[model samples]
Target: MGTFSDPTFRDLMAQRPFLRLWAARLAGTSANQMLMVALGWQMYDLTGSAWDLGLIGLYQFVPALTLTLWAGHVVDRHHRGRIVAACLATQCIAAIVLMAASRGHWASRELLLGMSLVFGSVRAFQMTAQQALTPLLVPMNLLQRAMAFSAAGTQVAIIGGPALGGLVFVFGADKVYGLGAALLAVSCILILLLRYTYVALPREPASLATVLAGVRFIWQHKVVLGAVSLDLFAVLLGGAVALLPMFARDILHVGPEGLGLLRAAPAVGAVIVSVVLSRWPLRQHVGRTLLIAVALFGLCMVVFGLSTSFLMSLLALGVSGGADMVNVVIRQTLVQMETPDTMRGRVGAVNSVFIGASNQLGEFESGATAALLGPVGSVVAGGIGTILVAISWRHLFPALAKRDGLQAR
Candidate 1:
């Protein structure tokens, strides 16, 4: 608690850019979290099957994957604030459309899937822009602290949004979408409050030179590559949150309200851990910290998968989330601190591709695994696979851990 409540740390946001950035991130993340629950609940309400929810993920991933490179390049070339505003605006429109469709009698899963595609695409761009803007907001010494603030805002959003989304759905989908739209709309307004006038990227338009340069830079930088790849595979294999509805409806016999808790449990764990990080920092031994955290994440997944009880599942997920939070802080610090000033946009994009690999694509992997093995078996197998990958990676990429932090490593 000392880390979070420390006056020194809170004073770090004395700068206007950091304050505005924090508010903007908080607003955006809350809306994003609301959409996550709303989407899952909406899809399940329509299809009543895990397979269809998986298809919703399939629709979302296509655009998130397809447009990443172009989005990165555009972010590198344009005004990031404007880019973020446009994406938020697009997402606002998507939410309104979704609400309208939900209110109508003619709603179809096909149309909803199309809407997901659009939102996912815009989100990809928005995320890249937001990440690139962070280093510009705060100095290097505070990057880790900045990440904790970011994580906390996201955790608040994740916890609050789903809890509220669950309640809003009882009223109607319109209310849920209205809440998401309001949050995102407010985010657009708050982002404009940034004090600094960051010049857009120079007009030396790149053809293939910039693209390959960014990719090669990341490839050559083992630290960046390793940190991202760890998240990519761990979440890819061990992510069980995507399938919470199945456990909620079929296994644990809980309603949407209980489902909200299941969904929020992980974020709650993350919030707690993030607060700790914000207070005390990771100390030394960043390399070993990351490995231990990820290994713990794998262990938690295994426990969660085998448990049949609702409470057990929540506990397991909470542990997994806690471990993942440690991993997230370490990796984000690595990325933000290590990335060069000029290459932030493209570098952020590369990171997103890794995140996409971890999340949307991971959902697909989980879905496929569930179909092959049952849900229980799939989660256990995935968790075990993650552990094995961590072990293999440690041996295969010994340099990744031995490497130093940030620029000097």
Candidate 2:
């Protein structure tokens, strides 16, 4: 009975549709994370080259960046749930193909990179639809809490996915892909069960004018633009994730299991913060809060880059992750709350591109720099760059810095 008193949990449970969506997200995210771990490990194992590892990120990024605008337009005019379900099914098929390839001893760098391209394209559309659909599932007042809970679910997947992937990899890489396919299947089923229809805007003729509206909207909304761009460039410059496999194998002297632990550490810290935020949302000086958190994230990156001891590195990463969680919750809430329903898909698309670019391009930057400066120097320089980005953004986006709360203006 006392458990029901928890407002975040209670609200999440009360809404069956939201619950279903949450579960589906958990399944899909976990599978994706697991697959990522497998892919990274496999790439490193096969090529033994950091440049090849960065190519994995590049392969994924290209499709997303190219198709993102068109995908967002499609999402705005379609049944979002069906779109998500279809995307999940496609990903499942891709995973099954990877499993067959790996099991048959036919998996190669080219095949893995090709799969990354496919999944990245599907995800470009899926992410826009899913992000747009979220605000429609729950009441307006509960949106922040819902986002917190949703992020918590993602954090949980992040925690379990790599660990599971690592454990399953011991059996075989094929087994990891097989499990990913299964989870993706489950995710598709869950999304198909959700009940909601989007209130689509009047369909305008396909033109640059229509497609480019989202870009203009984001540029005009200083808070949204600033928040998204802050995350974009900060993460772009702080490319710690790209060098993770190198750390796990060469630096830390730990195997796949250690890689899993390193991947999971940030999520472990993130889930804790998400749970807390769900219970008590941030209410004041939200913009400043995000800035401070990002700065802290940069500082922690510096610590993580310099650390040699495994435990100390994990601690540094965990703290960095906790700080990132703050950025995610507030930034997303602002984007959703500020935008109208008609514009959500398009706006979300812009945000997704920024995010995708940061991660994938960041990976490329990391790998390239690691080749030139070594992993330790590359990471430390990136951390210093992140700190500078934060300071620069604060001065540039005065509207974001001056904001007082998460509520829509």
Global Cα RMSD, each model: 3.2, 3.1
Estimate, for each residue in 86-122, the C-alpha lDDT of model 2 and write its tens digit. 9999999999999999889888999999999998889
Query: How much is the lDDT of residue 208 in candidate 1?
Result: 75
Runs of candidate 2 with Cα error greater than 4 angstroms are 1-4, 36-57, 98-114, 169-174, 245-260, 367-377
RMSD, model 2, all Cα superposed?
3.1
> Whole-model lDDT, candidate 2?
0.88
Query: What lDDT does candidate 1 reach at residue 200?
Result: 60
Which candidate number maximizes TM-score? Answer: 2
lDDT tens digits, residues 218-320, model 1? Answer: 8888877888888899999998877778888888899998887888888889988887777667657787678778888888888888887888888888878
Go through the candidates in order and give each one's C-alpha lDDT: 0.80, 0.88
lDDT of 1: 0.80
